[model samples]
Target: MYAQPQPQTTGRYIDLFPYIPWLLTGGMVFALIFGALWERTMVSTNLLVNPDTAAELKPIQLKKEPIGALRIDVNASISYNQWVTYEIQVKDQQGKVLASGIKQAWAESGTWVEEGESGTWAENDLMGGLDVRANQSEPVIIAIDVLEYSDTAGKEIDKPVSFQVIVKNGVVDDRYLWTGLFGTLLLSVLALFTVSSTGKVVINKSNPDSDVVARAICGNKDRLIRVVVKVQSDEYSPSSLHIRLTVNDANGEQLYSQTHLVNVKRSKSDGKVTSGSSALTTFFVLEPRGSYGFHAEVTPDASVDRTRIIVRENARTLFPVKVVTLKSSDAQ
Candidate 1:
């Protein structure tokens, strides 16, 4: 029998109007991104002002990116050769003077400005300052510090503030560092969360019988050796007797291993055999340093599918752990 062919309808371009919403959505998203970046870059979130070249300081930068930033080498040029005074008004978000201090110093018209840990300014030319191209100094560093208020319920007041601008060159402009380390722990936890969320950590292929990611304490990186033994798959363990295992090191050098037996028994007037030491209980321990790895095959052994690894340290277990110096701890 002959089959008749069917007719096909040509499709028309009718979906353009439907995609207008998506186009508008995409444009809005693009504009929003640029606007957010512009706002973040232009508007300074810091409440501290650094008129002279100074590095504004804050506590530990929560994320890898810094949060507190002040104007250093600002775009507008200040008229030099005369006493051009600049004001560093310190206040909180509500415009209250949290604390105030100065990073006083003298420098070339437009040299690099550096602030010390206490916000003190100094010329980098003295402490390894640079001689930029065209034989011109980059900018002058500013010195600064925080002055706590002892009267206003233990608050620093800006009253009786200094009027003259004291300029001195060649002072170290170190960043005002808040190094008590409170939020670093929070940052670390966030970092771990990011890592786990991103799953960038790759677990190298190894035997399943040993602990792949074991927690170990090493005193130092120098003179330390570690060995891991892994038992392969256990698919054949149920019906079969014994299996073979091997271990190796970074250089594929074999260190310690032995063949084991398993599942040798009988019943109904038959003699059964049993070993007291199970291969699962077998582990290794080496001293000082060694080159390693091994395989274990066993017959009549308990769970040779399980492997043991020997880890060694620098004969010490003192690992450094940072803790917060809380006010409560201080009182105690």
Candidate 2:
């Protein structure tokens, strides 16, 4: 007698439904970290800049690209009729030169121009230069390739080799200081702001980043500040934009003040106001680590005639930040 067909036993399997979202989230996080690491291994850049020299080195990635490339940029203030040359070399940890080339200076302009690759270096005469009065600092770029690959320990590797940039026969421009001095005096009179204590000093305790557009307004010989005024409509139908700027010193002395008027444009068909932006630049001799304050008054005119005045709002001030000089040593 078949003692009742033996009861079938089945094992339960784990379901992934509840854990799928968490697993996917963890996988995405892992992928992001891995992608960042892989990208870092592909390409890298080093920059060095100072009053005398500015240099940058960029190594190209060859993992996906068939041909490897290295780009170098050098900025130097060469005086009129002065000439300089540069040299690049790739050395292993033991200081073995794997590749060597000389920077070519151009003749007609006396600066390097984009000419196709000629071996590792360019023609000899292309490296010379004479700085123009208006444009003193000349920019030079050198692009090379991985002649051979090797590790820092001297073992053969399939990656781009690392190198150092050395400047030879280079001189610091003597006229640089003079240029800065003249520039500061000119910008102080034109674009700088000077506000009186009577107007307003709205200190921004927490400087929240605002959406404003600013471009190079003006400069003292070497330093400049950009200004952008955001005018919220004071009147329902403002016809124009008026901005007043004031610059104050540490002791609260007003150094400068200026008023700017921007005419509003309207569409002929519907008379709708068109949006616009205004920017101003000022250059001056700014002391390092010094705090400067900028205050602005924005008004929207609602007059039907261009000459009439419109309602105005209280002035606004941006949080003051110290001016810090940027150095090549700061770059990684």
Candidate 3:
């Protein structure tokens, strides 16, 4: 009777209930970050124009051999806009403007659509015109006749001549202008609302640390598009990370694929894996002028959840590929 038990303390349980709101708030914040990352910083990329600059020149050897021409493919990727303009210029190594008569630009009508996005095209709208729309790309053939060459010094012209292709002008429809805003919001939501996941892969235009974008590679047929895939692993895990990647064409034909592994090191004090990262680089060849499908698949170790992987494609988790051709009149 003297050892009666005191009332059990309920304060411990009450204190945890207050933290319930905090825990819920923290969870909501993390979910928003995850959503943004999954969306790839808003799915909004840039309107890219390839071969920002080009230059090549040689001396004429023979009159009958015909004047050589500088053939360059001017390509504009309309990812966020509907239309843009490309201005082509031919110049000597001296920076003097060459005559337009030596330059010729031709494009096949109804040959393309926006590079990454989808849309309908009419016969009148082709790569030939100055007004370029989303997903459309064409080659501009600049033929500089070496046979008619007249050097200023009357000597062998042995200088590196240059040809310039630029995205001199761009105009977007008012309706589609919202893409910029929407894209920003999408990214903002990603940054503010979602938490980054471990064991994730991010595809960027040129480098792993750069902004992720679907790029348009133009110019030479053998030109290569370098893509960087960045992967991450848990800081506290005990095991190393292994990531396998596969690339395929739109027809489901395999193009290129490989697997990468990252080793984890732990601190002596923490005895944890410590955060780890691995960057992988792969190249894709640009094909002749025609839209083609291409994508990449990433598979992490069984221990890492599949949902933790971040990729460009939302549902299929594959990257898309498109090819455009650049050729001279003779070659075309």
The most accurate candidate by TM-score is 3
Worst 10 residues of 2 by lDDT: 308-317
What lDDT score belongs to each candidate, Candidate 1 first?
0.30, 0.33, 0.33
- How many times do residue backbones clash in model 2? 24
Give the TM-scores of the predictions, in the order they appear.
Answer: 0.18, 0.23, 0.24
For residues 1-332, what per-residue lDDT tens digits would candidate 1 score against the true structure? 22222222222211233334445445555544543343222222222323333333332111121222232221112223212223333333344443343332223334444564334333311011111111222222232322321231333334322222222222222221112122333454444344212211111234444233332322122322223233433323333344343334334444333443444222212332222222232222222233333444455444434444444332111122111110111111
lDDT per residue as tens, model 3, 1-332? 12211222122111122334445555555555543343211111222223223322332111111212122333332222122223434443455544332222222224355768666543212132222222322233232222221232333333322222222222222223344445545555543322222112233333232122232223235443334455443454434554454443334444344455655343343654545555554333334432333233334433321112223311110123332222222223
lDDT per residue for candidate 2 within 266-302, as digits (tens), equals 3333554444333332222333323445565555433
lDDT of 1: 0.30
Off by over 4 Å in 2: 1-221, 232-239, 265-269, 274-285, 300-332
* Full ranking by TM-score: 3, 2, 1
Give the root-mean-square deviation of each candidate in angstroms: 26.6, 30.9, 31.2
